[model samples]
Target chain A: MKEENVIEAEELTKAFGDFKAVNAISFEVKKGEIFGFLGANGAGKTTAIKMLIGISKPSSGQATVAGFDVYTQRESIKKNIGYMSQKFALYDDLTVKENITFFGGIYGLSRAKIKEKREQLISELGLEDISNKLVGSLPLGWKQKLSFSVSLLHDPKIVFLDEPTGGVDPITRRQFWEMIYKAADRGTTIFVTTHYMDEAEYCDRVSIMVEGKIEALDTPKKLKEQFKVDSMNDVFLKLARE
Target chain B: MSITLNHISKSYKKLKAVQDISFNVEPGELFGLIGPDGAGKTTIFRIITTLLIPDAGTASVAGFDVIKDYQAIRNTVGYMPGRFSLYQDLTVEENLTFFATIFGTTIAENYDLIEDIYVQIEPFKDRRAGKLSGGMKQKLALCCALIHKPKVLFLDEPTSGVDPVSRKEFWEMLKRLQQKGITILVSTPYMDEAALCDRIALIQDGKILEIDAPEAIVNKFPKKIYNVGADNMYKLIRTLQGYEHLYSVFPFGEFVHYTDKRDSFEAADLKSYLKNAGLTDISIEATQPNIEDAFMELAK
Candidate 1:
């Protein structure tokens, strides 16, 4: 009973002139799984992510994201996936309701459904009182949660989060993971990149990249066992040092 | 003491960025200010570096008053801000040289102070600072901060976005710098990094929640914690949230951290409860508290 892979990459490579930013990396992400992509700064994590998300073309090899070809069929792939970057992409000047409506509009949701979802999202995040307030006036934690909620407005098959919890506090990070768990429970595949090693342990499986290549990939437990370390941070340190 | 603060406070209109807070950093010790964004870590750093004036109280660096001896404090301390501040268009070597020249020193004179770090970036000397990788930029910023050979250093979230490996290397560099008797004050939101500091002040909402050695802080967590996991994690959390004896249930990595309101609660009781609730693959084990656990307890 093998589950279908939501993402499949075979020797995916991306080169910038003489520099091969993502070189010959291959991995598979199962449907409804939280896959953590980790690497040191400049280790090609972003380059690889860009290729999969259809923003950048691979120089060689092949990849299929949400069952759509990376080289072609990019538009279909884009529609089936959601993305949230380190920077919260909500319009600051717009109110919370306005930001939700704007993103829902871009995703082409029906006006009626968008109205329903906007109410649901605002209530779920306990932003009811601040629904009419400008987004810039909200706190960092609230803004991040709002950004995450907006990314899923279209109910995409997969979500890509790049360092989504970089500067947040531990308490907020805990709450954010709860959101991730809820999304995963709903059968949406999560493809995320983060610097927090502890967050790696939260993933169903993690792949470590270094020097434009996949250095290691496995469940956090197995990776820790293979590296003979007690924590994922130690496992990463050992691999990155190599 | 290399750094000292006596009831320092700073405010922006109605928002108190830093409320009456006081602490001391020993000479040559690595101290961490652990907090979240808008927690006033940067405000405190700015005041100590003499960049922003504190609204009340006083601070000193290297025995010089932050207000009276701003010039001496600036000369004797190194500060690396959260944002990358080097000339983006300048090459790595050019940026380092410019910083050295401004400090009335040459690379040749301060070569030993930055040798270990500089060597790592030397190969990329011709690359523009902005073009360098995050790790390389961090190293370059550190090198520039050290070019003057200051006795004290203040780093505000230096490894905020850096990878774990580069973070380890940066901390190793800090250790080497400490060996040279330079006091360091660093702020980060990462809880794991708190363990690397000799002592840390857990701050939030412009107040110090706790301050002590990392181990001591973890040791101070009030209750026994159990790691609980089952097939349905979200359900497990919801069920535990409704449990009568549960104090708190928060997700930690792969497991939900559970603490009981009753001190005498046992793991078997939790295991049986989960099993009765139709949770398969249920596992419950007692676990020691970490910095985050301590922080959560203190924050409550």
Candidate 2:
């Protein structure tokens, strides 16, 4: 069964005053595929995600996520998609359980569902011992994983993660990707951004952004072959140089 | 100039940030301090640069005592802090000029040292340092540090939060600076970056784990390594972990990196083990260990 794409964008553009953060980028992510959005810092990856998730409006072009128009159906799109920002974004002063409950409530999950999801997320992330601990006290890896779990508490149709593994240990990053794979296996489209070239190889497909545009987009294997490079790192170096 | 740290330990209240760390950095060597966050890399850098004095132990840079000859040490070493501690309100050019003035030198005096990096960001020279991009901020901070032509350069995670391209560029710049025979001491959390150094000291939990060349560190892994892959990889890892001879099993991208408990166990045995476990399309191959692998083994 060839399911329809979970995300589609055409000539998407976003301008902040005179700067075009995301310029004329177009890509599609099929349902259940892990799509990697890659770029250098300040290379428009975050801006594109912001538009696709309906948090930032695109100045031009058309986009649809989870079958909802990004411009007209912002509410519907928000309800069906999850986003984890570059910054941890969770309230540091809140307890682990409180953060979970707060995010669940914001997503409009009922009180019963919030309680159920909170318990499940805590147990899955092995945060039970620290559930009562303040979020500030948790390690960076733990905070990242917990933030990811909370993002998926409502079982959105798709999830967007912006550099989710930045500054995390390789082992922790490995574990986090495992969670992403599990989610994708359950038919959730995964959209993620990362600076680690090796991590790009994990995606089913990846789009490399330079300046404000998508310079290259393909499966990691195809990109490596196209660039005639042995590793993703070499492929990135080749493309970034151009 | 060479650096020596003898029984260097620093503490704050009840917490020990660094504990009795002793090491020597030879002249013209690119020494890297590799570790996770809060691993005392920053504290050690501060102590060595004379910004913070250790409660005990002694440190000397270029034969000058770090505490007693603080001014001399500061003048002889260039430091790029972990947090990009520079004057954000000033423009890139202004920051460079101000730092050079503090050291009683002009940017023109050492223009050749940072010319390559400066030229790339010269167009944005008028932009405020705070408004510059992550990579640009890194370059500006570096130029400011090197303007004084210090004998030793210290970079504390200079590539953090930067794009991969910028990271490559920054390292290239460091290599050039090293070519001028400047002793370099850099700290990074990235194991991959550790490979670029002439020698590296792996730190964890505020303690030294291992200190050696990256290649030597990788060669020290005691177990036979293998990279295994197949469809249903998660199930494969679980099954491999159950095998009697498995030393460690961890996911490495699309494949699982594993080591055998017994030297007698061969690659064929691993393949057959997966085959017998009802796994299909399995491929197993012996693999070379990397710096991260060595660090993981040592961390355990």
Candidate 3:
């Protein structure tokens, strides 16, 4: 049985002047699948993510996110996907409850639904005591978790996380992964980029981009065996070293 | 120049950024302060660089007190903060020149010190610092920091989000600089990079957990860790966490690093526990703990 793909790309390319930041990359993310996008520091991950998220226009090629065309239906695509990044996720000045309600409103949720979600999120994340506190007052770990929960307030078909757990404590990082796992279990497609190679192992399949090209794409186990490496870190080291 | 911290402590209001943190770095040695963000790595860096004075205790960089001899210490050390502190509007060459000029030196005088790193970004010298890419900006930052060519270097999170390739190359450059008799104190959130340091201080929650060589740190891990794998990664973790004798269950690459609460733990017994949970394709093997495993255990 072929799994339904929520994300499809055919030679998606993005260029700047003479540099092809994302060069003709093509891949598909199956529904509910956790896809790991790996690359070097200067590799075209940010560019590729922009193209996939319907923000920046691709220089060439074709792609669709959640059944919406990248070229003509970017607005539709935006409405069907959730985005969260470590750099920017939630408003610092807003209280936790306010942030949730605000994001729910932005996602076009009704008042009743937003109220229900706000309560559920607060209790689920064990933030009852701090729900009324400003998001900026919370610890980095808590803010990160709150933002992740808020990103799903509208229940987008897919969630694109850009290094969501970077610099978080190890325990909290694991907790965040548990959240990702639960989300994937509920059939939410997760497309994530991370520098932590170990997190790359948790994905259903990972694609490593080098110099704006997808060099490898496979399950973590297969990639390890194919490269004769014990861990994803070594596989990355071998590929990225060159 | 050596670095010594004698019970150095600092706090920002209620947060104890660094509490009684003490460590020593030999001359020309590469030392790493490994921890997560908000773990007081930056505070410690700031204290050593003479940018922030300690609330209590004392710190000496290159035989000069951080407070009493701030100017002498500043002149004796090169510091690259975690954030991009260079003038964004200035061209790369102009930024480099500006840094050199402020230190009462010319780029030509210390061109040899930053030659290897500066050469990489030299092609983009004419471009504005803000317009450069992430990797290029890092190179330019290093160039500006090294223009003064001090005895000691303080680098904060030099390779936190940097990829494996650039991180490797950056460490290589650091190793070369260390060879030239410059003590280097660098911090990173990446645990793997800890292995590259001569010695490392594992820190968290404003305190030092352990301080030793990377290999030695791993050797001192009190518990034996197992690389446990199964068909479903999430279920495996959930089941393992539910085990009665669970000490720690961290999600490592492709496998979970499982430790038992009891010293007399058996793999067969755990395998049967997982099997009862309907977990198939179970593979359990004893593995040598790395710096990360050591860190998670230490911080836990």
Candidate 4:
């Protein structure tokens, strides 16, 4: 049986001036799979995510996400996807519930659904005590978790997390991964980018970009075995050194 | 030339950034202050570097009070902030010179301190700080921090935004810097980097979680670890969690690490149980824990 892919890219390219931020990259993410996009700084991970989320236009090639054309059906694609940037994108001054409602409203969610989701998210994330508190008042890890919960308020088909756990504690990162697993179990495709190699190992499949090119794409174990390394850091070291 | 932080705590309004944190860094020791973003690592760094006054504690760098002798502290210590706080319009060489002049010292007095890192970016010394890559910016920042020959250096997440290769190279530079008998206090969010430190303090929720040598920290994980592999990985994980003896079953690469509540369970028993539950290619092996594992255990 041919498996269904939630994300498909064909030679996707993005260029700024003379530099090709993303250079002719091709890949596919299967439905409900956690696909990790790994790369060093300036390796085109963010550019690829932008094009996939229909925010930035690709310089060349064709792509489709969630069965919608990236270039032509950007609005439709945006409706079917949620995105969390590396830089926290939530309103700092807004209360936790207010932020969720605001984002849910932008996604065109109804008042009843938004209310239901707000309660469910707040409870599930154990944020009931601070549900009325401003987002800026929360700790970094809590804010990060809140940001993630807010992203999925609309229940989009796919969620794009760009370094969502960048500076969070190990315990918080573990909890975030549990959240990701729960979402994946509910048939939500997760596409994430991170500089942390250990997080990359948790994904079903990871693609490593080097200098704007997709240098390696495989399961972390296969990549490790092929590179003859014990840890993802070693695997990255080998590829980066090459 | 030792660095000492005594009962250091800082607060902004009601929120406590650093809470009663205390530690001592021996001369030439690479002491790592590791934690999440807002765990007060930066606040502690600022206190020691004489940037922000601690609410209730005293810190001394090279025997100079961080509060009373701010100028002496400033002159003897180097600080590279978490963010690239250098002047954007200044060239690499200009930034170095500017810092040197601030400390009332010339670049020649400490040229050897940054000679290795400076050479890589010497050609780009004319390039504006904003024009350089993340790695080059890191190198330039380090060069500027070291231009005055500080007896102690404080780096706050100096490798946060740089590439993997650059992070490695930067740590290597730190290793060389330690050879010059400079006490270093470095903060990073990455746990792997903690292993590079001679000693580390794991901070969380404005509290010190633990502090010891990295190896000692890992050695404290009190659990029997096992790496479990199977065909139906997801289903197997859920099933393993349902088992009465399963303490923790986290995803570890292609395997689910299954640690039992009791150390008495045999691997053969686990294999048979998994086999009966329709798990194919089932594999189990006792595994070692790392700093991350140790942190999770403590947090739990």
Task: Give the best candidate by lDDT.
Answer: 1
Residue B38, candidate 1: how far off, in angstroms?
Answer: 1.7
> Could you tell me which residue pairs clash in candidate 2?
none
Task: Tell me model 2's lDDT, rounded to 2 decimals.
Answer: 0.87
Q: Write candidate 1's Cα lDDT for B176-218 as tens digits.
A: 9989989999999888889999999999989999999999999
Number of residue pairs clashing in candidate 1, backbone atoms closer than 3 angstroms, sequence gap of 3 or more or interchain: 0
* Model 1 lDDT per residue over A148-168, tens place: 999999998899999999888
As for DockQ, the candidate ahead, 3 or 4, is: 3
iRMSD in angstroms, per model? 1.2, 1.8, 1.4, 2.0
lDDT of 4: 0.87
Q: Quote the chain B TM-score of every prediction.
A: 0.98, 0.96, 0.96, 0.95
DockQ of candidate model 1? 0.76
2 against 3, candidate with superior DockQ: 3
Expressed as tens digits, the lDDT of each residue in B65-108 for candidate 2 is 99889989889999999887888899999999999999999999
> Which pairs, if any, clash in model 1?
none
Between candidates 2 and 4, which one is better according to TM-score? 4
Instruction: Put the candidates in DockQ order, highest first.
Output: 1, 3, 4, 2
- Output the chain A TM-score of model 4: 0.96
Task: Score every model by TM-score.
Answer: 0.97, 0.94, 0.96, 0.95
lDDT for B98 in candidate 2 is 96
- Tens digits of per-residue lDDT, candidate 4, A83-188, equal 8865867899999989999999999999999999999999998888888999888877888888888888888889999888888888787667878878888889
In order of lDDT, best first, we have 1, 3, 2, 4
lDDT of 3 by residue, B1-300 (tens): 399999988989988889998889999899999988999999998888888889999989899988899999888889999998999999999999998999999999988899999889989889999999888888899888889989999999988788877888899999999998888999998888899999999999889999999999999999998999999988998898899999989888788999888979899999999999999999999989998888777776
Which is the winner by DockQ between candidate 2 and candidate 4? Answer: 4
What stretches of model 4 exceed 4 Å from their correct place? Answer: B232-236, B273-278
Question: For residues A1-242, what per-residue lDDT tens digits would candidate 3 score against the true structure?
Answer: 97899999999999999999999999999999999999998789989999888899999999999999999999998999999999997899999999998999999999999999999999999999998899987878898898899989888999999999889987788889999999998999999999998899999999999989999999998999999988888899898876
